[model samples]
Target: MHACARVGLDFLDSAPYRIVSTVDLAITPAQLFEVLADENSWPRWATVITKVTWTSPPPRGVGTTRTVTMRGGIAGNEEFLAWDPFERMAFRFNEVSTSSMAAFAEDYRVVPTSRGCHLTWTMALQPANLAGRIGLSLGAPVMNRLFQRFLHNLRRYTDERFSAQ
Candidate 1:
């Protein structure tokens, strides 16, 4: 098991929280998973993820590290904790010196449905300090709205890509 699973449970007890964004796409779970698992394609599909670069070498699976720049120039480093093709994947913010969150975990899952597939993105975050905690509490709604947009963007991108084929 990754160290992340063992740490932060007690630290986050006061602020245990999770934000989830989900979408149903008219595409196979495998197809959607491919797009998500390909880190380089993030900027093309998810506008919020403005840029991505592997800090370490690839065949991107568990333990791969990458730096991601978000919409407003917020850069963070991520480490893949779990990778399960066509089913689910999970990652954590690992080494972003500027990030205010002490611990952040994101898990993405793609589940097959009768028509297509349901994709869910879930994030767990704990601020680094007391002030950071207050800020997150206040801005949670805005953050949630943005996450929804990210999910919708994924759906739009996947649909357009597959339609053109």
Candidate 2:
């Protein structure tokens, strides 16, 4: 994997390309966090993700590391920037299999709601070159829809999971 430019929390706010997707889940924030913490749960909800392996041990928190394998064999080495359990979790890729990205990060925020919880997922990226920029720009619309679909998948997965238990 090639090293990606290290990005800070500020990048989530300032990245040139960002997609924010929100969904309301009929589960508490803790339940949502449980899904986030379970590596096996990722592939079940986020279709683009194939696997997740925690590089760091238990008690996940800031600076914890993980490797995520996505579709198309793309892999990312990530480090957590914020881990507030049920409320917020964010991470940035320290390295990636592709050269098209200068940086990439994601922020997941959960807020309690009357129904259950509201999740706002934000994906931020900086393209490495003109080709990358053009590709992202052209694919933005489809990507946005795909992201929202992932959240809907999450909602269904969680609903089935909790109801079964």
For model 2, residues 1-165, the per-residue Cα lDDT tens digits are 988888999999999999999999999999999999999999999999999999999899999999999999899999999999899999999999998999999999999999999999999999999999999999999999999999999999999999966
Best by TM-score: 2
lDDT by residue (tens digit), candidate 1, 1-165: 112222332322333667888999999988887787677779876777887887778576788788788866677777777778888877787655554667777888789999899988888877777887898889889989988988787888888889976
Local distance difference test, per candidate? 0.75, 0.97
Clashes of each: 0, 0
**Which stretches of model 1 miss by more than 4 angstroms?**
1-15
Model 2 CA deviation exceeding 4 Å by range: none
Q: Model 1 — TM-score against the truth?
A: 0.84
Model 2 local distance difference test score: 0.97
Error of 2 at 123 (Å): 0.1
